[model samples]
Target: MSYDTDIFNALRHRLMTNGFEHGQKVRAEHLRLEFGCSASTIREVLFRLSTIGLVEFREQRGFRVPEQSRALIHELTHLRVLLEAEGTAMSIRRGGVAWEARLTAAHHQLSHLEMRLQSARDTAPFVDLWFDAERHFHETLISACGSDALRDTHQQIYCRFRQQLMIEDRAFDFISENIRHHQQILDAAMAGDEALTRQKIHDHLARHLITDAQVEPA
Candidate 1:
């Protein structure tokens, strides 16, 4: 029972990273051998991951990592911009110095890694660490939004968004621009400019939004 989280996280991390090729079948029997659990247990874990859009099931194909969808990516990107913008605005209003400090701390950690990544000839060694730090900064931007429902929903969207980022951008070619965007967002939030903060967040992810994705003003 206690190890259930370990199993779930193990599978979730794999799906998020390069562990499984897009649309590759996930085998319960193979995972069962690795975890020393029943195939049924592995199936249960994969089912949970499916709910988060990291995995999918077909009529008879069992479980597999989802195929990347340009449409789905655009939709998820729009939602992320909306949720993150609104949440950050709320945090700026409600969260005071404490929230700012946490946000600053999170940004510092993320930016440090981004700077290193900016110049590295090989990014593989820093990939996972950079992803974790990046997620932490965006998450902290809304940590003080004070609504569990909003936070929970954003988390689900973010997981899918992160997975998409992994699939589409392995080389980190835009890492320089990303570093700038992250810094600007932090500056806006720190200066208590809600509108600007919202805009910065949107700008950071605007590339992901297809031209057809008509995002409303934040």
Candidate 2:
């Protein structure tokens, strides 16, 4: 990978995982010294991230991570439910055995980590592993749907959704419920029941919706 691409990805991950605080000014100088790159290179990377809604640029203030919003989280949750449910349904119709195998494997890994985390005194050690596993499971849900555009859009939104909740999610208070939700999703998918899979996906993320009435896949 190219140096600039490396820096961009590192910054993207830091932004997504709460490496930098929300609404904090991105210090290009510090990054330049740390990355051993030029100021303009960092600027280019920040601008690229800005296009994806991971970072925001103000005319005089330069770049900063976007602040969290409850309304935004609700909207993101709704979109996630719609896209994930549709994608899983499409996968069920077209994925065959290969997709099922992949989804099962993904869930196994996530489930193992969650089970261990559920009883851990300190969740710090499992956080990164859990993030990767959780993302892998969800991404595998849509991987065989035969729509790159859908996958790309879902990925962008997923990252933003994680970014908004990174601080809140680190507490691990919801891990137990998440375990049940993920198992239900896995079982529904394995059974090749599209409607049930859709419902399970919605249930997994319903808390983030925070609306008066819970939304289901349409």
Candidate 3:
């Protein structure tokens, strides 16, 4: 638990769950107890997070979560949908029987993990499991798309979006609805229904989240 990169990531993950809200200083003493990190190490990690725009560091106020712009989030999500959809189509066309089998297995695994994680009390471990499963399921479906660069880019954007989602003002109802959407996409993909699969994925991604409840006037 001492000052280590893993500890930094753990703290970052926890902060993410709490909305990564800006303007809340992370005092050295508090971080020392929270992550068991030394002041120097904590400062270094804060510097790194600041570089990524994940944290905002003030000269006199220590650190706080960065405030992300809605416009930026929208742009990233749109690019992700375009890249992922194209990759998925390519994967469907180029993927062989083995690829299909892997995708199916990954989807099954994700479904099982998601169900268990939903009911668990200590949700942290389940959150990690769910993240893994979700990534695996998406990767397996698009692994045969023939471009490692494209896949890597898709993955980076996906990870960033997932981080953004962690900070969004989402309701429990949204979570349940998303789970069902995942199931629908999985079903369509498994059946090799290209048109339906694309349509479902588009619908899943295009569900506007611009409700006033989520947006606050600045």
Backbone clash pairs for candidate 2 read none
TM-score of every candidate: 0.93, 0.94, 0.66
Ordering by lDDT: 2, 1, 3
lDDT of 2 by residue, 1-218 (tens): 88889999999898888698878889888899999989999999999999989999988778988888888898888998999999999999999999999999999999999999988998898988999999999999999999999999999889899999998765488888999999999899889999999999998898887765544434
Model 3, span 1-218: residue lDDT tens? 54567866776666555544544666767777776657887788777766655567788877876556666567667877788778888888888788888887887887787677666666665666676777788777679889999897786576556656665534333556667877888788768777777777777767543545556755
Whole-model alpha-carbon lDDT for candidate 2: 0.90
Residue-level lDDT tens digits of model 1 in 32-117: 99999887778878888888788887767788877787778888999999999999999999999999999999999988998898
In angstroms, how far off is 47's CA in candidate 3? 9.2
Q: Kindly report which residue stretches of model 2 are placed more than 4 angstroms away from their true locations once superposed.
A: 213-218
**lDDT value for candidate 3?**
0.70
User: Which regions of candidate 1 fall more than 4 Å away from where they truly are?
Assistant: 213-218
Q: Which candidate comes out best when scored by TM-score? A: 2
> Residue-pair clashes per candidate, as listed?
0, 0, 0
Clash pairs for candidate 1: none
- TM-score between model 3 and native: 0.66
